[model samples]
Target: MGLLFGSFLNVVIARVPAGESIVHPRSRCPRCGHQLAWYENIPVLSWLALRARCSSCGLPISWRYPLIELLTALLFLACQRRFGWTPELVAALVLVLLLVPLSFIDLEHWILPHELTWPGIAAGVVLSWPMGWGRVQDAIIGAVVGFLVFWGMEWLGEKIFKKEALGAGDKDLLALIGAFLTWKPLLAVIFLSSLQGAVVGSLLLLVRGRAGPAPDPEPGPESTPAPPVGPEPVDTGGEEKKAEDEEEEEDDWEPGPTSIPFGPWLSLAALEVMLLGPLLREVLPVPLDMLFAGAR
Candidate 1:
C-alpha cells in the first residue's frame, strides 16, 4: 500500500509545481509521448524491469522513482511497528504521506505550495478528534501558536537584517506540524530543526561554496556579436535580436547565500519527534529529557 501511494506521490511531486493536474492525461513519456502500459507502472519493479529507461523513447528515467517507493515502504513498516494498531498509527501514516512529497518538493523548488499545507492543517485538527477533546484543543492552540511564533521571527528578522529571512510558506508548514503534534513539542521541533539545518547547511556551504544553489550569472553585452559590415546586407527582420532577448529572459534565477529551504529540516525533525522522542527522553539526562518528553 505504501509503495503504491509512493508511486502516486511521484506524479504529485512532478506535476504540482508546473500547475498540471496529477490525474489528467495519464502518465506519458516526456520525450516520446508514449502512454505508460499497466506493467510499466508497477512501482519499483517496473523501473528495474525496464532498466530505468522509457520503452518507447529509451530516455533514461530518474532513479528517484524507485528510491521514493522503497523509502515509503520502509517508513510505513516503521510506523506499523511503533504505533501498532491504533489511531496514532493512522495519523502517522497520513503524516508520512504528506511529509515525503513536501520534503522532496521543497528540496527541488525551495517552495512549499499552500495546496498541501492548508489542507494538512485541517486534517491534523480533524485527526485529533479520535484522541480526545483535550487533544483537539491542543491542536488548535498549537496551530495558532506555531503560526504566530514563526511570523514574529520573520518580522524581527526583516526589521533587523533589512531583507527577507524566511520563506513565506515556512510558517504554514510549522503550523501544520503543530496542529498534529501540539504546542508543547513545538519548541523541541524548532530546536532540533535549527540545529540540524545549521550543521548540514554549513557543511554544504563548505563543500559546494554556497549554502544553496548558485545564482545564474547575468548575461553581458559581450555575448551578442556585432553585425557584419557589408555593402549589401540581407534583411533578417530583427530575428537574431529577438532570439537573444528570449534566451536572456529564460535564464534561471536563484536565491542569495544562506538561503536553504527549511521545510525539509522541519519535516525531518517532526518525524523524529513522532517516532523516537520517547527513546531519546529515556536515554538523555534529566535536563535534556524535559525537552523531548512533551512529545511523548
Candidate 2:
C-alpha cells in the first residue's frame, strides 16, 4: 500500500507545480513524451525490470522513483511500529503522506503550494478528533501558532533586516506540521529544523559553492532564440500573489548563492519528533534533552 501511494506521489510531485491535472493525462516520459503503460508504472519492481529506462523512448528514468517508493515503505513500517494499531497511527501516516511530497517539491521547486498545506492543516485537526477534544484543541492551536511564529519571523526579516528571509509558503507548511503534532513540540521542531538545516547547508556551501539551486543564466545574444510568445510563465516562487501588485516587491529579492529551502528540513524534524522523539531525548545530553521535554 505504501509503495502504491508512493507511486502516485511521484505523479503529484511532477504535475502539481506545473498546474496540471494529476489524473487527466497518464504518466509519460518527460523527456520523450512517450506514454507509460500500466506495467511500466509498477513502482520499484518495474523500474528494475525496465532497467531504469523508458520502454518506449529509452529515456533514462530518475532514481527518485524507486527511492521514494522505498522511503515511503520504510517510513510506513516505522509508523506502524511506533504507533501500533492506535488511532494515532492513522494521523502519523497521513502526516507522512503530506510531508513526503512537500519535501521533494520544495527541494526541486522551493515552493510548498497552498493547495497541499491548507488541506493538510484541516486533515490534521480532523484526524485528532479520534483522540478526543484535547487533541483537537491542540491541533488548532498548533496550526495558528505555527503560522504566527513564521509570519513574525518574516515580518522581522522584512522590517529590520531589509530582506525576505523565509519563503511565503513556509508558514503554511509549518502550520501543517503544527496541526499534526500539536503545539507542544513546536520549539523542538524549530530548533531541530534550524540546527540541521544550518549544518547541512553550510556543508553544501562548502562542497558546491552554493547551498541551493541557482536560476538558469539569462540567454546570451549568441544563443538561439525561440519564436516570441506573448509572455512566458514567470515563476512566482509558489506564492499566489497578484503579478501586477507584486512586480516591484518581487524584484527586490532573488535567491542568493547560499539560499536553501527550509521545507525539507522542517519535514525531517517533524518526522524525527513524531517517530523518534523518545529515543532522541534519551540520546542527547540533559541540557539538550530539555528542548524535547514536551515532545510526544
Candidate 3:
C-alpha cells in the first residue's frame, strides 16, 4: 500500500505545480512520451527490472523515483510501529503523504503550491475529529497559531532586514503540522527545524557554496528566458507584455547562493517528532522536556 501511494505521490510531485491533471495523462516517458504499461509501473520493482532506463527512449530514469517509493514504505512502517493499530496511525500516515511531496517540491522549485498545503491543513484538522472535541479544538488552535507565528516573523524580518525572511507557503505548511500535532509542540517544531536547517545549510554552503538543491531544467523554450546576446523579442504587443513580464519577475524569488528551502527541514523535524518523540524524550535531559510537552 505504501509503495502504491508513493507511486501516486511521484505523480503529484511532478504535476501539481504545473497545474496538470495527475489522472489524465497517464504515466509516460518525458523524453519519448511512451505511456507505461501496468507492469512497467510497479514502483521500485519496475525501476529495477528496467535497469533505470526508459524502455522506449533508453533514457536513464532519475533515481528519485525508486527512492521516494522506498522512503514512503519505510515511513509507513515507522508510523505503524509508533502508533500501532490505532486511529492516530491513520493521521500519521496522511501527514507523511503531505510532507514528502511538499519537501520535494520545495527542494526543486523553491515554492510550496497552495494546492497541497491548504488541503493538507484541512485534512489534519478533520483527521483529529475521531479523538473527540478537545483534540479537535487543539488542532484548530494549532493551525491558527502555527500560521500566525510564522506570519509575525515574516513581518518582523521585513521591517528589520528589509528583505523576505520566509516564504509565504511556510506558514501554511506549519499550520498543517499544527493541525496534526496541535499547538503544544509548535515551539519545539520551530526550534528543531531551525537548528537542523541551519546546521545543514552551513555545511552545504561550506562544501558546495550553495545551500539549496540545483534547479531542474525547465522543458520548452518558453520556460527559459531569452539570452541577452540574442536578438530582442519584437515589442509588437506593446507595454502589456512588458508589464506582465515584470510582474512575473517580481513574483518569482530565486534563492541566493546561501538560501536554503525550509520546507524539507520542517518536514524532517515533523517526522522526527512523530516517530522518535518517545526515544528523544527519554534520552534528552530534563531541560528539553518542554520541547516534547505534547509528545504522546
Task: Tell me the RMSD of model 3 versus the true structure.
Answer: 8.1
Q: What is the per-residue lDDT of model 3 for residues 186-220, given as tens digits with 9 covering 90 to 100? A: 88788899888877776775677556675545633
> Model 2, stretches more than 4 Å misplaced?
216-253
| lDDT per residue (tens digit) for residues 54-141 in model 1 | 9998999999999999989888888898899999888888888888888888877777898889999999999989989999999999
CA lDDT for candidate 1: 0.79
Better of 1 and 3 by lDDT: 3
Score candidate 3 by TM-score against the native: 0.89
The order by descending lDDT is: 3, 2, 1
Q: How close is candidate 2 to the true structure, as a TM-score?
A: 0.88
Candidate topping TM-score: 3
RMSD to truth, every model: 11.1, 7.3, 8.1
